[model samples]
Target: MSVFVTVLSLSSLATILAALVSLADYHLNDYGVCTININGGTRTVDVNGGSSILSSLAKHKIFIPSACGGKATCGLCKVTMVDTISPVLPTEEPYLTAKEIEGGVRLACQVKVKRDLEILIPGEFLTVSQYQAKVEKITKLTYDIKKFRLRLLDPAQMEFKAGQYVQVDSKLYGAVREEVSRAYSISSAPSDRKAIELVVRLVPGGICTTFLHEHVKVGDKLTLAGPFGEFYLREGADHLIFIAGGSGLAPIRPMILDILKRKLDKKMTFFFGAVSRKDLFYVDYFRDLEARYPNFTYIPALSGAKPEDEWDGEEGLITEVVARNISDPEGKQAYLCGSPGMIDAALGTLREIGIGAEHIYYDKF
Candidate 1:
């Protein structure tokens, strides 16, 4: 019995020692230098080898749009190796389309910079910059939506289009304590240079939304790393129709303000939808804007209004109201922002109203 106890203790100590050694090696091992050629070698980044290419490029301020935070799930961190390439990994196969495979596209978050490599990035990446910022204000926009304003600290400023969105860095909660990022659109006009604002609706279990709603207070430092998406105005568009719901109004507000600031003389009609009066917000803001822009009209549609609530406005689904009102969309362009369902319904209505598919634009929240 004594001999057996001694053997068991020895085994346990050995296992613990092995774990410690393994961890030490992972942390202490030397990763030689690697070079990444960017934009056909128009730019290059020298970074430590053996880390994922996404992390390497991000360190140098080149951001690849990733939806799953830097994890491999979202399959958005796409890259085309411009140097010699390796065979695709099993983890990346499902995400790559056959065309992407033929074109040498691989997941940037998964590929390590094992050797000198060249990569091709979309043109938009050159314009996106990461920001270190301080929270300037956090105001209640509605009962459930709060507005956060971030005054950038480093690079100190940015130039983004009216409808573009940025990903806000988030601290983890529940079982996740690591820092991560989530995307939200800029609500303030681009003319507001010093600070940018975001309207965030509380998602019950959302990592970033929950942090902003519960833990984040008035003054906190943060890092945000994006100016992503291709949803914005199309100048020379014949006429403009805008649709939005809930916090989707964030992106649309900038679009409206952009139009106003630019003195766009185009015909514009804006529709805001809500489940009930409680869900409705920013009606007064829109009303004031409509008064300023004679060609612009603001319509508020309520899908679940109560008669006893003494409401007087267009009622029913936004799409239904749109179908009833707009009879001609032959030369019109539609911009939509809302929940996925509302945008989908609005798209169908545009189709039914004889609008060309090419004339519709949307950014669904």
Candidate 2:
């Protein structure tokens, strides 16, 4: 009984000390308001110091694409520090390349704002706005993939290019105690300004994806921010080659629709890779488009088709199918979206087939 009492007393003392230290640090590290200079003084925001650049900018309504919230994991919230050169944290080393580091690019989530900062933000990021949206519909596209249709409520409209992406915010649910943000490409066409569609594949332990797939329901309110990424179509290429797999189809779908709606003269060939027929979605949609539009063609390739699949389409890796189909790369530009491994392999294959590196544009998730 005496030993138990003594241990309790010690634990109380430790807790008191920890609280005192936290209080002291809170008071001592209270940096006053600091100014954030953006894009050579194109804009500036004054924010309280001692918070991360990511959260600080977010508080001021400047949204950056961060799939991992502000946890320094996604490495998507990168901003170029123009005047201040800070040490890169160990968490940021794996995401940044030597060239990026040399260019003073730092993960905004990892950088604490203690003083005034001068940074370069992309022109597109300046246009992004937060929105209150309602989950209008949810459609099961595959065993692990679902399509979420979000209708903007607060601001009834969003202007974005066909291939841009948006960041969806998730509430804490079940075992997840922290809110998270994830980036998903908009699958709906730009013509539909009132709503957007996101194609999400359930990652085994993904925080945002799991929340979206399981906890989110139709009519539930959600907060999202948007119109990020530079994966949209570029003009001047008469022949466009699109290659994607899984949820990578999100952005390409809109691009294809936009092109067809505009009645563009460009010839489009889409190569969709999947493990089997079960993994494929929007096949009929693209096939209908192909039948109506002579300039468009849809090719779904199965790399690992099972006997039960009864698949008789193109059988091989996506890269191999692309190589087999395309003989001439002249006046052709390629847009690819998929896993990093698939993108890297496609890059090599496209290069071998005489596609210029400048003509190959990709968005890797």
lDDT of 2 by residue, 243-263 (tens): 999999999999999999999
Error of 1 at 41 (Å): 0.4
Which model scores highest in TM-score?
2
- Return the TM-score for candidate 1, rounded to 2 decimals: 0.84
Report the C-alpha lDDT of model 1 over 1-365, residue by residue, as the tens digit.
99999999999999999999978867886668988988887888899997899889888988887756777766778889865478888889988998888898999988988778988988898778988888989988778899999998886988888888888888866786777767788999999877899999998877788888877876788888778877888865757888888998899899888988888778888888888888888889889988877978999899999876477999999999888879987668888988879889999999999988888887543
Clashes of each: 0, 0
Worst 10 residues of 1 by lDDT: 67-76
Give TM per candidate. 0.84, 0.91
Give the lDDT of residue 328 in candidate 1. 89
Off by over 4 Å in 2: 1-27
Which candidate's lDDT is highest?
Answer: 2
